[model samples]
Target: MLVDADDCEIVGEANGSAEMERLLIESAPEVVLCDTSPADALRVIEALSGEGAALVLLGEDHSEYQLMADAVLPGWAYLRKEADRIEILGAIRAAGAGLIAVDRSFSLLPGSAFPLADAEILPPDETLTAREREVLQQMTHGLPNKQIAARLNISQHTVKFHVASILAKLGASSRTEAVTSGARRGLVSL
Candidate 1:
């Protein structure tokens, strides 16, 4: 587990949002470290917000981009690759303590608009659990519970449980309703 002596645990690593989502669901890490393209990073953070893990975004340059991403969740930390170990460790500790730790570069762009600050459009109550989201995603494909269970390697009862949870979470009365609701809410597409 010793990738470095400074960090306590390696915890988990993810190549993309989908895999990150899985790891987060299973391990429930205290923080998530992601180095993603600017556009994709915003979407990933938005999708992963409900899990309570502080987000730490790592990349180089793009002060404005960091501002945009930081605005999504003030508790997140944005650090540059050139930052020293002390700074990096400090950011990690700050993020773990649920505080915002924006890179110093962002201060230079003081007048720059935090583009994503007011860009998130979802209602506060609309977020769904990872499982409910999976069901809704399957519903988007017009898949039946049996088919979904087979695909997810879960029992049919578990699939039914997920479907029920999806319906309740999405405020839909049926699978079709759930699919439509999910699509409209940007949770799924068909």
Candidate 2:
């Protein structure tokens, strides 16, 4: 595919990290587009860390989006190599503007989850009170405040307080975010 070479300047290309590092220092481009597997992408991402040029990775495996998205930051994205010229170009433009452009194929929206490996586990919140843990357990069952209060034999006000504390400890802005974060940390199973 020509990818309409006229759309943007092709600074340079490299086969691996060593060559890419040299090209990065020499060209100092605004955004770097890489076509590689998720494993290979990790090496390039590490090499380009703090190098100033934003990255747009085009990985071959769709299931690796989580591992790749874990590396997400301003102007950093994981797109599919099968992305068309428009999608690729749009990602490049977004990267240059310090914005992220996640691939449409990924179901990575808020509250969505991908199975996590044990080695990639997040830190569990050890600061939660026993009562707070109980509240979180109820939350995983989608219990409303009134129901939770009934189950825990606590006042609705007390339930709200525990919920607020749970959110704060999990660094989540919403109940769903809290639950997702909680599950990721093995605080709750859902």
Candidate 3:
């Protein structure tokens, strides 16, 4: 089953660890959002080591997954369930871009800690034009071409033209891939 939220899409859903691993192998999505216990989420993350998929874990507290993220998964995000929608989406976007995006709430947790060295910093490319960057940011919001055009006060043809240029510049074959590349290159923020 597929579920769509914000600018992210869930290509598969699993009820148990075994099923989740199977789905991960089969679908190979760019990012996996898991709302399970820390232990369960750890198992899933370990199982996906070679799959090249990023993770965004949601739980009640930083204690749930902080250590694992710090020690095991460097390019992952652990967000509290009560996190803001923008932060949640940002985490997902960052994970898809192969970056760590831990929520600020975690730092406020009593005795919470993170390994500074675990954070990954991607270098930005300055190839995109100002207009193209605007289009790319709107793409991260999951906007369709028409809506992007209307919001940017441009015609649909212009939006399409920008999208095509973005794809070509990023060497991406699809819109989603282009957005992922943009995020990875620090060119777009969710």
Candidate 4:
């Protein structure tokens, strides 16, 4: 589906690796845009290699995929989900031309070339309830408590409660921080 422009035609779409493999074999578009988690992106990339299609991956975490792309697929582009429309369009076009287009902010290497020694160490497994996880997922869209409550078929008060719990569990002072932390921890996808 076309998101913000009419000039670019969407040849195909897929939700998972198997569907993506089928679409890649059927359509073989010059460029493929996939929005998924890092692990899933790896699976999709592996599933469609040698198909001669450039890949543009949009995800919450880029470092893992960046490393993989550098080692395996030079034509792949990994952009953060929060990337602006211009960046996304540029990445797609560049990838279509068989070139690499990466977000400069994210490094293509693993681990700390520049480590933050004092970074907050979140617990290895901060358990979030199912409802709280759903609320946090909605928060990633920048939705308000009212809209999230309506979408979840819950009361606004309940949404607020879940949000508060999410923030506390994530050690975040605000909704934005909560989403950011959740994404970094692989607890939520963007």
Candidate 5:
């Protein structure tokens, strides 16, 4: 599909890890499309790291949440195989332009209807400390630092510290992103 896209140029395709490595080193394309196994996709992400090749990972029959969590850096996309052509191409373009794109298969907005799945979006690795989790929950309610400190019976300075910790643990740059990620991981609710 990417080969046919007007915005993309087909460089090389790989059938195995060795070939993929060769193609990556040789072609060094602006974006990498991966629709294979999760392991191979992870490898591709690793290979492209610091090389400026954005990754568009298509999850079919794998643990998508885990893969998405592992796709931590900017310029990474995690889309379901069911994504339409337009969605796929848009994600690739966005990633290529150094943006993080999450598939619409799950609405990850702050108060979207997307359910907290049976399992967490990320489990232990992104786990927040007890106090950090409290701050995150306050953040879910859109509480400011002063309000959170008052509610949690802590100093505003302490609240700020916990907020920073929550953002770091969740890999979020802002409070809203932390809340959304926390909701997806069943750590917080809207």
Candidate 6:
């Protein structure tokens, strides 16, 4: 018999995270096999971390959450949905033993969901912090510093600091130019 056959056979199947929750409580199997969107995977792992089972996440190679396996999945195993049978079995066994398992293909970049093997999508400004990226998201919306500050609940001065940093980093002489440049480079939405 396949070592994975027993637990894998009757594991819960849900097309989305909500149904997965109900399935988790009702079936309560030893393992869960799922194909979830990046955000959905985060939610499922958050919900199921302390439940009495291992979760084997199957996701496409480029799924964003595949990059944060450590932080999101404390004790679960995560692997590319395209793994061969042997590798899948190994992850299942490791997860069953209560150890977190990860595919070797993931990277260590914080706040970046891009896979290690792929080229990085550096926001024209390599020096920008993740917080500033949030600011840029608002800037792309044509919000002024005061409005961005109000929406982010940060002080206007802090927003100005980020704007100055963003200007210098992107080599833009003004916020409008920065927004235009950012939109061109896939850094922010127009």
Worst 10 residues of 2 by lDDT: 107-116
Q: Can you write out model 6's per-residue Cα lDDT over 50-90, one digit (the tens) per residue?
A: 67767778775435444434343334666787777787777
Could you tell me which residue pairs clash in candidate 4?
A: none
- Identify the runs in model 5 with alpha carbons over 4 angstroms from their true place: 61-74, 106-190
Off by over 4 Å in 1: 5-7, 60-74, 113-190
Q: Across residues 1-190, which tens digit of lDDT does each residue of candidate 4 receive?
A: 3575665788877888888888887887877888877668778777656667778888766445534443444366777788888888888888877777667566423331111222443555756878987899899999999999999999999999999988998889999999988766545656
Stretches off by above 4 angstroms in model 6 are 1-9, 60-74, 107-190
Q: Estimate candidate 1's alpha-carbon lDDT, on a 0 to 1 scale.
A: 0.68
Clashing pairs in 6: none
Candidate 5: global Cα-lDDT? Answer: 0.73
Compose the digit string of candidate 2's lDDT tens values, residues 17-116.
7789999889987788888756677778776667778888887665554554455444766677788877888888888788766675553433333434
| Superposition error at 17 for model 3 (Å) | 1.3
lDDT of 1 by residue, 1-190 (tens): 1257465477788888888888888888887767787767766777557667777777665543545354434467777767776776777778878886667665334333232433332456756767777777887888888999998888999998888877777677888988876655556545
- For model 1, state the Cα shift of residue 158 in Å: 72
lDDT of 5 by residue, 86-160 (tens): 988999889889886766544443333233344544556766777887788889889899999999999999999
The per-model lDDT (C-alpha) reads: 0.68, 0.74, 0.74, 0.73, 0.73, 0.69
Tens-digit lDDT track for model 3 on 1-190?
Answer: 1234656777888987899988987888888777787568668767766667778888776665545454444357888877667777788888878787767666544335442332332225527888998999999988999999999999999999999988888888989998887765556655
State the weakest 10-residue window (summed lDDT) of model 6.
108-117
| TM-score versus the correct structure, for each prediction | 0.50, 0.56, 0.52, 0.51, 0.55, 0.46
Candidate 3 clash figure, as a count: 0
